[model samples]
Target: MFVGAIEKVDQFTRPIHFIFRYYTGSDIVPGTATLFFVNEEGFAITCRHVARQILYANSIYENYLKFRGELRKFEKDPGFETQRTNLENKYKISAANPIRVLFNFIQCVSAYKAMTIHLHPTQDLAIIQFKEFESVQYQGYAQFLKDSRFAKQGRYLCRLGYPFPEFTNYQYNKVSGDIEWTKEGRSKTPSFPIDGIITRHIGEGSEITGIEMSTPGLRGQSGGPLFDPNGTIYGMQSATRHLHLGFDQVNREVVSDGQRRRVSNYPFLNVGQCVHVDVIKQFLREKKIKFYEQD
Candidate 1:
C-alpha cells in the first residue's frame, strides 16, 4: 500500500491534478483527478481514463475544428447580450472542433489536456512524461518485488487515493463530495493487504504477457502501481466491467438525439483492471528511463 505523495511540490514540478465530468449537466459535467510521482525526475504515473477526455480532444480536434462558422457565445446567467468571447474568433476552431478553455491534473503535473501520457490501449495503464525530472525519494521499488519471491496467496493489496476528500490541496474552498471516480480493476497496499492469490505466472521474464494466474481486480483503483513484498514495481491498476462508465451519474434525465430522456446511472460498478509491468518497462525504455529487466 503506497501512501501517495501529498505535498504538491515534487522534486521537479507541482502535484498532478485532473479535469473529469460527472452528475451535473446536459452532457457529462467535468470533475477533478489526482496523481503521484514514482521517479525522482518529476515523472508520475496515473490512470489513462483520468486524462483521456482531454487527450482525445487535442490529438484529433486540434485539426478537425479548424472550420469557419458561428462561434458559440455565452451569457452570465441573464446577461444576454452584455459580452462574451467569440470562441470562433478567439480559438481558431469552430463547432465541429472547439478547444476547451481549461484543463487540470490530479497530481504531479498540470493544465495538460494531453502531455503526460504514453498509454496502453486495452490496459488501464498510462505512462506520463514531464519536461524535466526530479530527485524525490523513491522507496526502492526494484527491491520490493525481489523480496516477495513467491507472492503470498490470500495476501492483500491496497491503494491510496484522494477521492472523497475535501481540499485536495491547501488552496481549495469548502467543496462537497469532490471525488476522483476513476475505475480501478485491482488494488494493492503499503498500509494493508487485499485478499487474493498470485494465481500463476502471468509472465516470467521481462514481459507481462500471461493470463491471470493471480487474484483479480476491483473498482475505482485503476492505474495503480503493483509490487512484490520488497515493494518493487510489478504492475499498475486497470479496472473494467461488462460495460464500463465510471463517473457521477446525473439524476436528472435529459432528452437525447432520438428525443427521449435517457437514463445513465452515476456509476457505482465494482470492478477494475490493470496493465502488466512489462509494458511499463517498455515505455520507460522508449523514453530512455533506464529500466530494469528481471531474470
Candidate 2:
C-alpha cells in the first residue's frame, strides 16, 4: 500500500523545480502538488493554480523563442554579440520553464504539457488529463467522502507531499546546473505526511467554500490531499493565509546615505487553506468522470 501511494504520486502530481534568473544570480524554486486518480481511465484532480502554471510556462517558452530570433539579428556586431552571450550565460538563456517532473527515482524527467484543463467556474479547482504518454504509471487511487459528518470542525486530517525538496535534494551543482542526488538519487524521497486539525469551515450557508487548517501548508505542499485518519478525502490544499504581526525595528550597519538606519520588518502567521472536496465532486461529475460517491 505504501509503495502503491508513492507510485500513484509518480503518475500524478510531479515535483517541479524552476530557476528564476536575474542579473545578479539565479534562484532555485521547488514546488509540490497533489494529484490522485478519480477513475481507472486516469482522470485526476489538482489546484487551479498548479494547472495555470503549466500553461503559463508553455507560453513563456514560446515568447522566449521569439525573443531569441530577435537576438540573432544582433550577432552581426561582434562586441555587441559577445556581451549578449555573456548576459545569457550569466542569467538564463531560455525563459522556458524547464519543469522537470521528479519521477522514477528522479532518474528521468517529464516536461508537463497542459493538454486538457477544466477549471471550476467559481472555485480554485482544476481537473487535468495528460495526453497519452509512454512513461505514465498507475497505482492506488483516492475515494471522496460523501458524508458531511467528516466535515465538522476540530476534525483531524493529514496531507502528503514532498514538502522540502531542498533538504531531500541536498546538494546542487552551481556550475554544472545539476542536482547532486545523494545515494545514487535512486532512493527517492517518498511523500511524507503532516497532520492538522480543522480550525474552522468557511462559506457556511451555501456549499462549503474552504476550510482552515491549524497548521500552515508549506509552499511545496499545495494541491495536496487533505484526508482523515482513514484516508477519506476531504479537500485539496489550496494556499496559506499570512496574518500580519506587529513590525519590529532593527538597526542596519549601512544605508543608501552611508549612515546607520532602523529597518522595520513585519512578521506573520501562516494558516493553511483547503478547497472542499464537495466542489471537486461537482466539477468531476460535470465532466462525466466516474468515481466513488455515497451522497
In model 1, the runs with Cα more than 4 Å from the true position are 1-16, 20-36, 57-103, 106-116, 132-155, 165-220, 242-272, 292-295
- Cα lDDT of model 1 overall? 0.41
* Model 1 collision count: 65
Give per-residue CA lDDT, model 1, range 50-160, as digits (tens). 556546745433332332122223433354333223443454433433233124443343333334566656545566665642333333223113323443444444333
Alpha-carbon shift of residue 281 in model 1 (angstroms): 2.1
* lDDT (C-alpha, whole model) for all candidates: 0.41, 0.63
Top TM-score prediction, candidate number: 2
Alpha carbon RMSD to native, model 2: 7.4
How many clashing residue pairs appear in each of the predictions shown?
65, 1
lDDT per residue for candidate 2 within 179-201, as digits (tens), equals 34444332443566667889988
Give TM per candidate.
Answer: 0.48, 0.67
